[model samples]
Target: MDPARSSSPNPATLAPLDLHASWARSREFGLRPDDALSDALVSPADLRDRLEANARLLTFSRPVIENLFRQIGCPSSTLLLTDCDGLILSAIGDTGFLDRATRVALCPGAEWSEAAMGTNAIGTALTTRKAVAVEGSQHYLTRNRFLTCVATPIFSPTGGIAGILDISTDARANLSHADALLRTTAECIEHRLIENLGEGFLSLHFHTRPDLLGSPLEGLVLFDEAGRLLASNRAARALLQLHGEFPQGSYPECFTTQWRHLVAWAAFGPLTPFPLRTLHGQTCIARAELLLPRAPHGRRQAKSDEAPGRAEAPPAPDTDPRLGHAGTLVAEWHRNRCAGPLLLCGETGTGKRHLLYQHCRDHGIGMPLLELDGRSLAARAQAGRDELEDALRQTENGLLYLTDVDLLPAEARSRLFEAAGSSHRIVAASRHPLAREAEGNGLDQATLARHGAHIVTLPPLRERTDFAHLVHRFVREACPGRPIRVLPEAIDRLRRYPWPGNISELASRLRLMLALVGDDSTELRPDDIPDELLETAV
Candidate 1:
């Protein structure tokens, strides 16, 4: 049944006399039904300022409003968003209806609290701390009698009232289901707020059944690293019958379980449902997800000597005589006490990154590697200075590998040079020379002077003598436990090609061939080569 149309008393609605009593109270507060609506409209400049101040809230609430509009909005309906104090922040809907709404000062920057607009849905919902539907004559103000409005208060993750979401339409329209829709939308916004709270928190998902553990109805409770309770979604609160602030205690205190057992379950194996009983004796199934801290970017250990229970790293590039000059340059740089930045210049797919990884492994450099693209870092720098600072902080006492150094913006490049000064080792890679870019003012000159002491230029595949060894290594890595047999003709075809995309391209081609040669086959023939590779045959 539509709660709005039910003959039984609506919990969200006041008795007819109670609404009249509210109107009497409004009059007692010196508010008149005949008051001019323009008196409540804020200046356009003030409206813009308020919107800018609430930019984050506007971003979070946009999807909810758009979704609700698609579901229930019509040519004669308007949606209003207000801050905690009942000042309209956004009003969006049908153009005609919006124009009509503005006549009653239902636009942005208009204050709609009981003192200003007199007992409307927005004000009533705020004052009563509940969902409210005020229709026609039920409005305390006579001028608002032509509209029906349903409003619900949106709550922040920390349990404070964030704002209000409201739907207002022509009173003649049937809006019996508006209250339910508004409440559902409000709950969705609240859940999203909870998910975006912060990092280093544990999320506990629980439900009456194991199958429902991750469903929308599942309870989500967050805890800090010390296992202290943080916040929870509505489903969690209802399941535990918790009220107000979560009391100071560890997670295991609320259930019949031990903290050590829960920690062991989270760290050791697959997520299995564990039995949990509330203090009230209600049984539930729960699973805990430990959100591990993000590892330094591009950090990988060498796997040339694999041991049991260790992850296998990417295959190392061939150490052929053709790369002797590059290796010598790296060795000299490592020997130098200066320990300045190193720049690696090479064409795309020429194994510059792999070469660096191999160098790190050979030199026994145990520092973590944080890899970032120049263009992406530049974009983040444009967004804010704090993002770049945070990234630099995370890479302290480690190696920062920046790829595509030529693509970094001038300002971002300058900032990066400033941040990287003497604190961390930087290894930058580019298709062109860093000195040339610095001359062009595309890169910071001081950064090049400080770090470009040893610029190693890697030879492309066409100029290298390691073709056969590289092919064998890649084949072995891609088709583990299976013998690789490449026809003589296929080998000649691969060797003669220009290899425009270089070693990376070669690795991909081999992997594809392995996929095509199922368990029944172990041979890679010329016919198995992609048509595109054959089209560019030398």
Candidate 2:
């Protein structure tokens, strides 16, 4: 519901009644419009107590507040987070802005509630329990008319206002974009607060589209061991049409998917998406994360692969020399851990996609991986459906991976760069380095310059030192439960061939060799190798 309509006003009604009410409240506080502003700060001891009381909010909100300030990039703008009472707990901005704001008591330790600060954005939002903007003369106090502020209340788990996130700037500054960003940022913070309540809760992350699974816009629902709804965020409430009654229902009342199936999926991992349908028939793609309590320390230690009671043998070591270096490059560009997009380049069958997945899994990067075939994206764009932009809206915290990016049409390439910008962490794969492709008129020069900041090139299979290891591993997987011994001469004969088709060709030939194996034969000989592979001997 819109805040302005909270008083049950008609859609066409309104002469700024919310503001008028705020003005009335200010007058009731005995604050004169022409009165001099107070520049006093709360005592140091009191400030310390407030900070300690809201430590969790600060821990989760600090990074978001800092990032918001960076995005504003205005020397006259300041970002602040305050408790429910409007006591400022954290403040960040340009040095010049901070100095100016401190004089108006807009810094940390100052109270900005409506009772003390008149009709200001932070104060008004808290009183109305909604997002609001107070600009220029809208402020009841004459002293505050020089500032423009937009604020939104952050809700706690129990459905009360936890705090307010506000952006204050010069009255002359335009805030058209700030309002939207502030709301989204507050939601992101609220989601984090709910996630922190993990013990004995089963958290469900879902959306109508699979590509949107890990994004901030995804609906989050928390359930207890008995499958009772314990808490939910704004997105969840809207998606489920809870109508203001949440945290009292059970899982069976909400979802048609059995509770046991959800538990089974959670025990495996949150990587795969399952079909989740509500009783109302809204189909959703969802992932479940089971947050069961940890076992005793000794029991937990025994479950580790390195523990003394390990039953299965450890896997063989990788012989690929390029994999480790590529992993470091990937970590450097991961959005949650670092910054920027990663451009992966390699020959066909050189395992570019494999490397991408391996690095993400090894590092425990849990964000959803939304892979888009560049050719398909371009095709859709030419058909007039702006698919790239649609995907961008659903990929706030996802890994957007584009495969065969070199195949994109010229117009689609431009659209990609413009639509993606810096709002997402994109990983694009191409058959060759983007710069080289640009020189051949297959890519945009500016696109190469932007995405080429960090590039990881994969070596062809023939050039890899791990050829033998990969062959053994692939063969083992291809013919499981029926082990075929590979002779030394057969291995040498295979290495003699120049593998222009790389790893993919090798696996194909191995599958064919396995097909020719007789029921009585356990050995793989050189004579069983395909004729074409031998004909291409170096």
Candidate 3:
């Protein structure tokens, strides 16, 4: 059974909280308005001096307004979203109206309920709770004569009108043929609202109506941080034979097995060489957001469609089970200059594996990265007892990153030593410092002496200066339009965080945010960031 279907609140009947509030409050707040709590949560102290709810009017309307004026081919359009009262919660139009509309209160806080503006779409849509249009001369106001309007009521999941969505175009223009454009824009806005205010980590759009939202394509889509779909337009849905919603979820869990490995690419540190996958069927990559919740929720969103092509083949696990240390160390090793067989000693997430690969690349070295993760190799050895030994002998001018070097089963260690004796550079990463894990409990003179010259300890993201920008860069890359610039205060919050999962966790959190609140504007407001991110202390 599809999990989302079982959990979703039926959209037909209105929920109690949503019932009378949006429509009624439209009048109460729009005409004689006061502040309402932000959809985001905050501490008690911060709410003392809140701005009026009218502030959200134009601030929120600008995106739609900008899209109408610039993106759409329409000759002229006016956009608005209203509250219960007949006030102009927010309004935007072409330069012609924008200049004249400023003569009245139409900029942000203009009241335009049925009582104030007299039976126009903004008020009538809320008052009658139905969409309406008053064309040139049909409107009560003289200035409305040259315009033809189309409007719809947007609703909360519970069936209450959250706001009104309307478009007014020049009557003289071929605006009658634009029903498809109106519907698509409205749906797109609804999707944005759903992501901002509801449950569910993923949002998938199939091309049922291109006139409503998105381009004319039919395929599966997964968005990057800023919330644009990855690939597979509407057409992919028919191709994949998907009968249900796509997959969306929290990090390390929601994505198919492939995503976890793809994310592991973060250990490469700087952005010098961007390694992308072209063979994965579709070249669509999402600059997706972090999906971790900033607070609690009552229901969950559905999953995004996942057509995982292949599992990336990484080196085998070493004898030790230190998961992340090896990867981070490899990442760091690659960053260091002329760093010899650097001995990486640390717990998981310290990033030893990535550093090793980077080491080879930086030096113009392109040999196969071999692994004698002693335990696994030893198991295969006892079982096979074949030409495997010869393969180990032939890896000349190549790299062998031996993870859990300290746990090298006697035979594998000997092979490694023999290999190290040759020209092959054996960069071994261990969980424990060689001296600490000494075989005799005194000084591990033998093992320590063999891999002596190069030992660099790996540190977690919490201890490194590289983390802030690293975290910022990942979040920005994933969320293309989201203003990833950390608010000075947000940066202060990041500084105080003790990153347990290191870079991986940071990237994951960003993905979560991108999936949740997707605002990729050049200048971002604090609320665009997740509340948990806001709560972080410096």
Candidate 4:
């Protein structure tokens, strides 16, 4: 037996407060108990608009509804999605409920607002902005009294009702579990809705239990680059003790953690959950999902004002100012150079390879950087063996950089371990911590323990505190030998734009800016910035 279907609410269990209010509102709409439901529906074109408007809701809800129907397996019930206005947008049901649904105009494009269907699930839930169940005889419309409908409102990222997810069944059928199911399904849809609110948003997921970090129960809060609280889901609002409306403020106003720290921690990905506490003294484990703004089109190709073949000076041993704590961490790694096998962990474009180059350059480790890819090694046995053996021998007095090490096959891993035990200085990199990958891949922990001891995580560009410094440095590099000044306004815009592509993306944009200028001694202004980048800023 399915746990979700284990219990049913008594027919009279729907609270009277909601019904009494709904009934009064229905009477006020001049809806008499005996009046028949009007044969009204949203027109085809209007329905299309509503469908497009609720596309995200539909996209995320369909799978959940299908799964719910399979779990319920009741021929007397139907599942529906409706816009905030109570117009049914989508519906699915069993053969037994199909005829009943059609007769009552409960199918797609049908209007079910309180004005049309009086004191019903979708309409009352919309009006009250709450979950509701209208059982037999509780419906204001005498025609609707033979059916039971439970509905929960799906809220938009901005906290307004986006749509409704409802389960409608024959009044005689027992569906006590429908209410819980609808709420849960609605939560899932709402969670995805907030998380995917595109570029330049930092989505933070948190829960009291570390294990619930990815589930619907987790609290989701979205912040703009300036750290303003853009939107939050139901769980977030509840977790933060937000009342009627989301308070107007920044992210730090609600949480104890600084915006920069959250951004940096999020770059490490979901494998690591950091502690986050609310201003109200509530603490939970949290992870951040960073969505950086992207260019609308391919990068502009233009010649720089500076001459070609300008050999840049090697970076000083101090650190890459763009990295902030990640830079410090890399510096620390270099300080303990040759301590053990090095593990560099972070999201892509986070400068894992860049750090390795810096480690050799700053520390003056003359060993050549020999590379072997784990995927290639895992894919071709003979070629990989030949490549690995060659790289190991060449880097015996140098360095061996192994990328995507988490993807290495067991055999490939054994060879690499043997090489690590040799004189070769080995550095392995992955998007996640090697230990976590070991557990996920069902690899032996003891094997990973040896190579994973010294791990350094590079923060994603969006999280780095030295964003402005990076912009200045890249801009200077782009227009080397020319007096180039980035206006404060342009710098502010660049800082607020989430650099999704990180260091490489930032450098590319700077080059584009110089290309666009096409002149010597240029002053970069806000207009010189990419329109896409500026548009994505808060």
Candidate 5:
């Protein structure tokens, strides 16, 4: 139910005579009209609103609100947040005006409800289900005759108007951006509505042009086919209006105008797919599909030529020559039970990071990889609860690769593991055996063991028969669109070298040699090798 529905629908019913007189009997009671009325009816805690939410309501017209006022180029800004019954909950503004307004019980609780106050910005906006700017002299109340107040109704998860957000300045001060600022207020309220709703469908809208992103006319619309309104936020209503009437099944248009093109396009394009912007007559008819929010199966690693015999295997993984064999590992791991995480052990040049990223492309996992240095993760965590909660939200169950966990400070080792516990995949890599450091840092032996599952050690270049394959591969790429080959003697020298930095070092050296050699067809020889490689190997 919307907050409005939760409370009385009307505020015209004046406070009970017994309770109204009770405030006159005491100073404390006199100072607080709210306490007097609520107490006579029930109590504060009975309302279930927290003190902080109430406090924020008091300063509703702070600099942030003023900045909004400035954005519209208005001279003064006054804000009022009302209870569901149209009774003022809180009012903020220039001190003098607000103080004066409140004394007349005009601040709150006197009930300037639409029923009592009649058609006005705050009341008419809610009553008509749209933003309203009542300029001076438009007010039904003679007292409100000199003011111009632009008000927009904010909604709850249900389409019901929850409160009114109004910016009241002098009528002469209104600017071109006034309408936009009113819509923005409505949009902000809807965001808070969604956050409260937790999860479900959310629709965003902009009044000026939905295609023109970042316009001030931005707004949001929220609903759940599941609930009544599910947050027909301001944006949703605008979008609905802009699109004309919603299709039969759609709920009420709450706060936006974005559906016209979507409905028009889907209706006209029954066969071949067409562009959404294509217009026929005044109506647009086309198909525009966003990337699917949920893919049925895990993302595949390779997207290349499929194996000839593999029956249902989706496409092969991506092949940037930079990610050769390890890229294959990333793909295969996704297809097979990566039931446990993979602990990749390799030197810097071994392309470990590239391999880890391939898992992101292929896995059905909802979370993308969330990387953090072990030291930073550890330091950021204050207590286990605070740290664990933040990590869980950020990681979203995806891979948490603690790169160079060995380099993490001794004090942080425990907290890092504690934070990693929240993620589904906790893949940690250290060039050295991290097991020994775990003991020194007092890391739980069980946690460290858990992270060590499926360790795949990358071999040094000298030990890899793949080195020759890599050399050949690099040569082919270097001379792409043409033909070039590595010299037999140079390959022999490469095989002989210790190759301390491994494949990455070799790839770099080859790229430099390729650049130096230009388009020459001559096979590379020892003389063509870098002096440093020769000095080290000779």
Candidate 6:
């Protein structure tokens, strides 16, 4: 039997022993068959708050519920969703049966746990940590004899019970396969939850049936590069026989393959379905998705090729006044003539290129500065390998600066990496983080590790502590010979505003302010600020 199927109870047929045990537990809890159903345990306001708190869960599970309803929907039946604690978070039913559901407080805000209600499907499923079906006289409360319910717990990616999915109806309605439908729907919701939670982690898809690899029935697992399991869907957990808060150790501890072999399969044969065996010898076909590795923290030390007396030192705040400490660090790296490829990461218009120019000037380097647009280079490299070689030759013994390196095609990125390693020093700038760019451009992890060993991250203008100083400097630069004073109120407004466009935006705004003031005017006032700035000021 499949591990998933073996672990779960058959929803269509409840075992006699399990049913009797639940009844005994209900009786032990002081519940009586003659007791009337109680009102909702939580107030309306509290229910609303709970719903809002679980908004993300609801978003992930809603599609699964709707799909299940379309498959097994019946007149006079209702679908209810609840938190792990058994508080009803949502309820949707056939219009004809809605009023009946409300009379029993089977709607949102009601607590249906055995403590609050009785041995019903919702409560029993929570208590037993299994799918449950309860009907008619099986309910502990006498007033609940009119209904039947099938409920399954939805597990989180990390293996805890996140919530419950339940279908309830009039006791007389035939719910032949209600249990199976509930279990499948719960699996779908669990799969979506895992996918959402698995960002930045490698996702693995596997199934006994090859066709099911991309389907909802496939087992989904997430692991880090080090082979540490991060998360998995319910199907994956069941298939792998994993339990408790988290499965421990590396991938090989849980699965039959070594981590090195799995990494090789992911890198070299991602499209091929490889054989994966569980520790128990259950075999299946599996595929892996490898995400870009995170860039190593901190800059690498300068290479031996660095100029004499150009070793890195801590940058003083005044080196690049606007950049604060970040500018000082970049200046040190530039002065040191670090031979490794340089990566400048920041948002657009944050002066990445300007800093590069400043670095070249400070070092008194007179070699040719060869500028290459990554998109254009990618196109040339695609035409023929010789074109790429020609470009590299042109930049020989000079600084090769590639702008928007993130946009380079995969083929071009590989060629660039080879050329960068052999011919010239490369200074690349990107509007995205280097790791994200590598992923988008499909560059090899090893190439990025080798080429981008020395990385500098520039902070956006809004994050800089010297906002007032930058503004004054820009004003002086834009006005030239004229001394243009800025009103205190105008400066306050500038500081308060969030500059989405960064330093370039600040300079543009300053230029406009200078033009508005003209040579005759000496001071820029709050009124002189652009209407657009005023509208967006925060």
Q: Compute each candidate's TM-score over C-alphas.
A: 0.50, 0.66, 0.35, 0.55, 0.37, 0.51
Model 2 C-alpha lDDT per residue in residues 1-538, reported as the tens digit of each score: 5222233223232235677788778878888777786755799999999999998888777766666666666668889999989999988887787888887899999999999988899999999988889888788777777888999998876567889999999989998778877887788778777776544458899877554466566788888899988787777877777765234578888899899888766654444468899877999988786553434431111122233332223236667768778877777666443345567888877777778877764665544456666755555554523666656654454557777777777666555554443566677788865554355437544765664446788888878887777777655544544556677688888999887767766776676577667655666788888777688698
Indicate the TM-score of model 5.
Answer: 0.37
For residues 498-518, what per-residue lDDT tens digits would candidate 5 score against the true structure? 766666567656756766666
User: Which regions of candidate 4 are displaced past 4 Å?
Assistant: 1-14, 268-270, 294-538
TM-score, cand. 1: 0.50
Better structure of 2 and 5 per lDDT: 2
Write candidate 3's Cα lDDT for 204-255 as tens digits: 3333322112222222344344333333322433433333334222232223
Residue 246 CA displacement from its true place in model 3, Å: 28
Top TM-score hit: 2
lDDT of residue 532 for candidate 5: 71
Single out the weakest 10-residue window by summed lDDT for candidate 3.
302-311
RMSD of candidate 3 to true structure, Å: 24.5
Ranking by TM-score: 2, 4, 6, 1, 5, 3
Which residue segments of model 2 deviate by more than 4 Å? 1-16, 38-40, 245-247, 292-323, 331-341, 344-387, 390-414, 417-425, 429-538
The lDDT values for all models are: 0.68, 0.72, 0.46, 0.71, 0.48, 0.69
* Best-fitting candidate, scored by lDDT: 2
Sorting all predicted structures by lDDT, with the top scorer first, yields 2, 4, 6, 1, 5, 3
Clashes (backbone N, CA, C under 3 Å), per candidate, total: 0, 0, 81, 3, 31, 0
Q: Which of candidates 1 and 5 reaches a greater lDDT?
A: 1
Tens digit of per-residue lDDT, candidate 4, span 447-531: 7676544667777777776666666676655554565666778877787876666776677667667777777546888888768
Instruction: Show where candidate 1 strays beyond 4 Å.
Output: 1-21, 44-49, 209-212, 245-253, 268-273, 292-538
**Pairs of residues clashing in candidate 1:** none
Superior by TM-score: candidate 1 or candidate 4 = 4
Estimate the lDDT of model 2.
0.72
